[model samples]
Target: MPGLSRRGERMPPSPIRKLVPLAEDAKRRGVRVHHVNIGQPDIESPEEFLEALRDPGTRIVPYGHSAGLWEYRDGLVEYYARFGIRVASDEIVVTTGGSEAIIFAFLALADPGDEVIVPEPFYTNYNGFAVEAGVTLVPVTCRIEDGFRLPPLSALETRITSRTRAILICNPNNPTGYVYSREELEALRDLVVERDLFLLSDEVYREFVFDGAAAHSVLHLEGIGDRGVLLDSISKRYSVCGARLGCLVTRNRDLLSAALRLGQARLCAPTLEQKAARRALDASPEYLEQVLDEYRARRDAVFEELAGIEGVLAVKPKGAFYTVVRLPVEDAEAFARWLLTDFQVEGETVMIAPAAGFYATPGLGRDEVRIAFVRKVPEMRRAMRILKLGLQAYRGAPARAGDRAGP
Candidate 1:
């Protein structure tokens, strides 16, 4: 028998979903599960989006242009204009998803074994993407103590070597929900420009900022104009995850050309989804306003509830819908599985992502889990209560008193 390829074997299972089978088993036994694991928002997709999908005017479902439909690309231009970022349709290469954009960016910018520096507790899928591209992901650990802000530029500089090709970041970062400010981005701008490296910016959660915090796009940076690649998604913005539509934007014609070639290699993104994603542009302000309000309430519910728990260390997330939580258990992954298989508060248990997979460096994030406050406020409150009670029962691993961090 032929053995499986190394890529298949090396690819790590998603920590965000690895415990889903256990969760299913719990559900089979009649345990109601509050899923706070993945960042699938419960907000409804825009009506216009559904309308686009159901249009009887459509005749054939054919492959789209390799660069995506010109109309859809133009729509993306208008979408960016609202944010004061300018890019031409030719500079945008629509991808299958933000996930595809990451892979394309890595392939376009760096060679195999070349390094890209990313902050720790980053989006876990980046590890898979790096492995697929054969690019080395170097970690620059950003402590929860610093609100998950970028470590000092000096510390970041230490990670850059001859093999370093780019620096990647996610604004309104996943897991931590730490929104990078304009000042923080500008500091990154100076460093990347000085080092003459690429800046791959994932701004999928641009509008999900909380507490009146503004998310600064890397495009807003003064320098590194040609080196910036903005990865934008319509998923969270319009609650269109199934749409699987996103685009890679860059002012550099070379990188743009390379990305388009890669797009051709994969054929094209789904034609129908691209059409539906165009409908996202038609979504009015009120839609996001209502969605934001609901998420704000959920965020407050989660923070307030977690704060009351005795030993749990939770940082208040400022953007996105997730926060990295430090649990008292020696192994957060084990505790997460135990919650699904063992503990239940009145027949309800919560599923959370063990944070260790979000880091490339081993032994980090073992004590932490990432919780998504994507449910409604009352559901979130109940989920938090389950977490509080579950922690009390799971060996009662003691944490230091008054160990809270973050603003």
Candidate 2:
């Protein structure tokens, strides 16, 4: 048999989805599972998106321009302008998903063995993308006690080196929903300009901010067009995670040209989805406001429930649909696995993502879990109840590896 490359061997499994067999076995035994592990929202995808697919209009479902369909790119122009961002449609290169946009950004800006600094407890898939791009991730640790805010600029500067090519940030971050402020963006703008580095902002959750908080985009920084890459998606906004359509927007001529070549290699994003996304982009601001209200209610229910628990600790998230919870147990992965294999409350259990994988440094986030509030309020209430009981039972009896003790 042929062997795989070192890159293949080095790839780590997703913390969001590693324990499937045990979950399947639990279900086979008639035990219910409340899945809070991933970010798949229960909200409905926009009706306009579906209506766009009703008509083919063409004899052939053809490939679009590598830069993207003129109409779709034009729709994005209108979309960004609403956010106070000014950009030409020519500057946008539509990709397969936000996942691909991250890859393209790394490929365009960095050589092999280059570094990109990110705040710790970031999106877990970033590690996978970094490995594929042959770039190193330098983490600037942020404490949960501080609500995962960006560390001091001085702390971030200490992580920088000559090889550091970019700083990647997730606005209203995943795993830890810390929304960046205008002042923070200004600080990063100064840092990137002073250091001659690039700023890659993941703004997929731009419209999901809660508590009357607003998201500050790197593109909003004046005169930083030469050093800004905006990676965006309609997935979360419209609850169409399977759409697999996203784009990289930048005014940096060099970055734009290089990213276009990379986009050409992939050909183009899904044709039908692009059409649907165009309609999605045109959705009324009222539609988003109603959707946000639902998320805000669920967020409050989950946060309040967790707060009532004796040993569980978490800060109220200002944005996004997730929060990193500091659990009472030492090994959250073990606790997570145990919840599937051993514990059940009234024939039901909850699945959570262990937070360890969200950090690059060892032993960090060992006793934490990242929970997504993507489900309805009632389901969230039940999941939180199960979690409270699970923590109490697991703390009293820490399940050793291979121990399948029942709750």
Candidate 3:
């Protein structure tokens, strides 16, 4: 057989789920796994979403408009308006998911071999998207000691080369849960404007900000009018991961045209899900209020528990439901695997994402793991307890002779 394509070979596996086989084996051997690896919410989706799916109101499922269902886009316009992001339905190209939107943005904004600057320890799937789009992602490192804030504008500016096409950011960032403040955003606005590059902002976790902090949308930035592209989704917002509904919104008609062509190439997003997304707009505001309250409690539980774990370095996440924790282990991935393969406390073990995969630059997150506080507060506390115990046991294990020996 001819060798598998290089692109297929180069694709990075999802670190969030790479340990599934071991977890499955653990389960087969009668161990309970407390999954804090992925960000799948345990909360119930809104009732209106289920109702819309149950009664799709169409006799036959047909291909939607390449841009999206008109009514659905109409609903999205109002939804964006609620965030003070004024966008017309025509400027939006609904995608299969935020993943698709990112890929499409990369396709529309840059050519193969062209570069886009992104902070290190960004969303891991961006690596796959960059691979698929054939674009190069340049990393500007953000330190966890600084609460994962955007680095100095001078540092970001230093990375810009002639081939640099855009600066991509995830507000309420994944893996770190650091919400970018408005001043930081303004500095980005100034940088992108000065460099004449696109500002691709992924604001999927806008509703999950904690500590009374506000998430500033790129649309709200004064100088970023035409240069801004907003990639958003209902998956995390409404707990509809399987629905796969998301959209790319921008004021740049040229970018929208490019994205729409890509959308046409893919045909269209799922039709029924668009209807469900429309109905999701009708969800009571209290739904998110309650959801936010629960996540806040979970976040507190995670931080409070981590504080008691000796040698674990963690900063309390300001937004989103995740935190990147520096573990005491020499190899976080090996420790993560050992948790599933060898360690357990009273028949229970916790699964976490080794944070190395979340970084584009090599060897940055090797000592860290990303934990999602998706479960309820008590469950999160218990999972942390299991993790703490697991750490102690892993350290004392004879297999970690190298860990005990200093460099």
Error of 1 at 154 (Å): 1.2
Q: What do the candidate models score in CA lDDT, each in turn?
A: 0.88, 0.90, 0.91
Clashes of each: 0, 0, 0
Weakest lDDT window of 10 consecutive positions for candidate 3: 398-407
Give the CA lDDT, 0 to 100, for residue 55 in model 2.
75
Clashing pairs in 2: none
Per-residue accuracy of model 1 over 215-318 as CA lDDT, tens digit each: 88888777768988898888899988888888899999999899999999999998998888788688898998888888888999898998898878877888
Q: Which stretches of candidate 1 lie over 4 Å from their true place?
A: 396-407
In candidate 2, how many Å is residue 386 off? 0.3
Per-model TM against the reference: 0.96, 0.97, 0.98
Point out where model 3 deviates above 4 Å.
399-402, 405-407
lDDT of 1 at 54: 90
Residue 62 error for model 3, in Å?
A: 0.7
lDDT, candidate 2, at 143:
91
Across 88-142, the per-residue lDDT of candidate 2 in tens digits comes to 9998989888999999999989998999999999999999999899999999998
